[model samples]
Target: MNLLKKDLADGISFSGEKDGHCITCLEGKQSRNYSEELEGKCLQLVHSDVCGPMSQESRSGGRYFLTFIDDHTRKVFVYIIRSKVEVFEKFREFKSQFENQTGKQIKILRTDKGSGYVNRDFKNFLRNQGIKHELTIPYSPEKN
Candidate 1:
């Protein structure tokens, strides 16, 4: 620090470790705390997400899989599909089966703002069924 001051920076003052531990270091020693919210009732809230165009397809030539999760029961349902177009069909199938088994209609459907769930047909179906559709904040997959 003294060498640089003499050779280049004559006007600027450079302090080398003047204080003790930094603010960042103090914070880094602790873990983050997240607030907890109330969980919904069974079939009252459902989350759906789609993953794929996998490198290898399924035996039926499916390239994608759709997932549905129940918030209250922590139940998960999955369907293998050939493409994004099959999302609606698969969702309908899952909804029917789940409703039949649980005797409850899904009240809310939460999903990312992906094309498969954002299309017109998907929204229309949700509306017709009187189910609320929730899109997670754009660019925040953690919300999903």
Candidate 2:
């Protein structure tokens, strides 16, 4: 403290303050406490998304990939496809496999409001299956 005072007195300047003993800068900073609700296991909540039409196609002639992520287990299922049109079928496959493997039904289906998911057939299927379907607000994945 004396040295810093002397330096300032002598018109010496530094970019930031340095405590001689600690060799660190002191600056105004802020932090916040963040809390999150615990997430349940896989087969409990799944996140689904579709990605791509690559410049180049895969060996299977797939240009896109559909992903189903088990939120709790962090296990991911990726299905390659040539179009978004396959999302419904791929979702069905995921639903069947996940249900069979875990012996637990998918309680919710979440996805962006893509045409593939909002069509009459898809809406009817979800209604008939008694699954809760949640769609993200337009142009927003954070809401999903």
Candidate 3:
């Protein structure tokens, strides 16, 4: 274990044998990869996605759930809607609430290339507000 090595280097002694395999050490070894930096606080960067037309409908006759995730705080906002057409209205509500609460404008939005997000109205709204919209390439949820 790197911790054990560091402890031994710092003159700390352990009664255990050094020849034995350390689970912690083995688990700790990993290849590093670069990850994108998270935007700080709320309303800075939001990832939006629509999930499901469930096999069984909800009590309110809703089948899909739209989720908005704050990149920095990892807070999630979920909206249950009957159709994808409601995404714009739900997103508008989310935008207002997030900005009101955090006092920060949403700078960028990341989402898959879903029509719910990339439609003319949504694109125009983002452009008019000077917000940067980022969309994943077709068939690439991993990018989003």
Order the candidates by lDDT, highest first: 1, 3, 2
**Per-prediction TM-score:** 0.68, 0.66, 0.69
lDDT of 1 by residue, 35-63 (tens): 12222367898998888889999999999
Clashes of each: 0, 0, 0
User: What lDDT is reached at residue 64 by model 2?
Assistant: 90
Q: Residue 84 of candidate 1: its Cα lDDT?
A: 88
Worst 10 residues of 3 by lDDT: 31-40
User: Between 1 and 3, whose TM-score is larger?
Assistant: 3
Scored by TM-score, the top model is 3
Candidate 3 on 49-76: residue-level lDDT in tens?
8887899899999999999988877778
Clashing pairs in 1: none
**Which segments of model 1 are wrong by more than 4 Å?**
1-40, 138-140
lDDT of 2 by residue, 33-95 (tens): 221212344466677777777889999999998888767665789999889899899888888
On a 0 to 100 scale, what is the lDDT of residue 109 in model 2? 77
Off by over 4 Å in 3: 1-41, 138-140
